[model samples]
Target: MAVDPDKAVLQELARRNPGEPFVMLNLLRFAADGRASYEEYSRRAAAFLRQYGGELLYAGDGNEALVAEEGQAWDAVLLVRYPSREAFSRMVTDPGYREISRLRSRALAEAVLQPTTPWTRRAG
Candidate 1:
């Protein structure tokens, strides 16, 4: 299971929308005894998030899925909005942030970090 973004994907993410504000969807599955580590990571990462204009809109523990295939429920979910893709890229690459990122890596058994573009309303 993939837990972190690679350089290639981060580059691709920046190239796609370097200037547009976007939200990141985080689907996390914790490793054994991982939640505590992840909480610590979140605490440390808050400073970086503020430094780079990232806002955590929502975070919640997952409950039983009302509708989903087997093995589809996540352990936690987070919606984080960034000023732009570049800001997100910068945050991840920052040396300070990188130092603490290991906590996140050890905390998750698997993760999905997806960038989301808001939909525009269509004129009727």
Candidate 2:
């Protein structure tokens, strides 16, 4: 049977935070062999996020990120925190962020962005 990757990720997240209003942002950046510039791209991405008052909770690279049950085929992953989903969207659509995104696109082979909004469940 084929596993629904999105479901799996969401289930894993629900197990961790059963009743919390949180958003999970997953970034997948694949780099060309021996030509990937993750270091530079990550620095710029980090800076762009910082400008919007984004708090980076965690950062993972190809090595460590590969352990995600989905496996780390990506060059990097970043976990960031924001007050709300609208806020996150605003940050991405910001004019300054658009310019930074251009540089990011050039530094990676591919990028996948996932935004997850969680529901808070009340316990009996």
Candidate 3:
């Protein structure tokens, strides 16, 4: 597949909105026994998010820079920034997303979603 650098840039811009209410949906897939089909799932998930207006500020498999200290502990780490909280919710529940849910579930033994609000610094 041809990689659209423009799309990636736009997505990254959207994702890097520092003051926005971003949700860090950390998916901790249960795969302690063995490795899941993370590579495939990660590719698909990136494509899926790009279809919408999502920027991937960060992506790694533990060993990469900016990743957690306890690297390799997770099969994957994805960060997507939406325009709004509702937008995030709708994206998950959307018909298009419904199909991808299976891909997500199948790739991991289990998972976790951790939503967070991006901290904003006020000008003095």
Candidate 4:
């Protein structure tokens, strides 16, 4: 039930190719009656996202998993792209953004924030 990133997580992210763009995959499981709070958090977070050169590529509620172990389905999924890992790290640590982050923490019982690197495609 990790609702927020810890120091080690942020440190690791900063240690990576800090200037490389990346997409973050968010898997969220809400607490009871948590959706409303999360919605508010999303609204407030948009400004910070924009300020940090982040974009919301996709967001959708989860449906039947089709293939997963029991209890594996999430309540929602979000894909957010950032210009660089450093930008993301900065955004999350900003004092202003930190104020509204409580809404996100309270809204989720569990969450997964995984950063992904795009694979280079070969020309045909």
User: Highest lDDT among the candidates is held by which one?
Assistant: 1
Of the two candidates 1 and 4, the one with more favorable TM-score, higher being better, is 1
The best candidate by TM-score is 1
Candidate 1 residues lying further than 4 Å off, grouped into runs, are none
Q: Lowest summed lDDT over 10 consecutive residues: which window, candidate 4?
A: 1-10
Question: Model 3: which ten-residue window has the lowest total lDDT?
Answer: 1-10
**Can you give the lDDT of residue 24 in candidate 1?**
96
- How close to the true structure is residue 108 of candidate 2, measured as C-alpha lDDT? 62
Residues 74-100, candidate 2, lDDT per residue (tens digit)? 666767775554455556666876666
lDDT of each: 0.97, 0.56, 0.55, 0.96
lDDT of 2: 0.56
Q: Quick one: ranking by TM-score, best first?
A: 1, 4, 3, 2
Clashing pairs in 1: none
Q: lDDT per residue, candidate 3, 8-102, as tens digits?
A: 44345345543355655564544544245555555666765666566677766643446556533555566767656445554555676667566
Residue-level lDDT tens digits of model 4 in 77-100? 999999999999999999999999
Q: Residue by residue across 1-124, what tens digits does model 1's lDDT show?
A: 9999999999999898699999999999999999999999999999999999999999999999999999989999999999999999999999999999999999999999989999999999
Q: What TM-score, over all chains together, does every model reach? A: 0.98, 0.57, 0.58, 0.96
Clashes of 3: 2
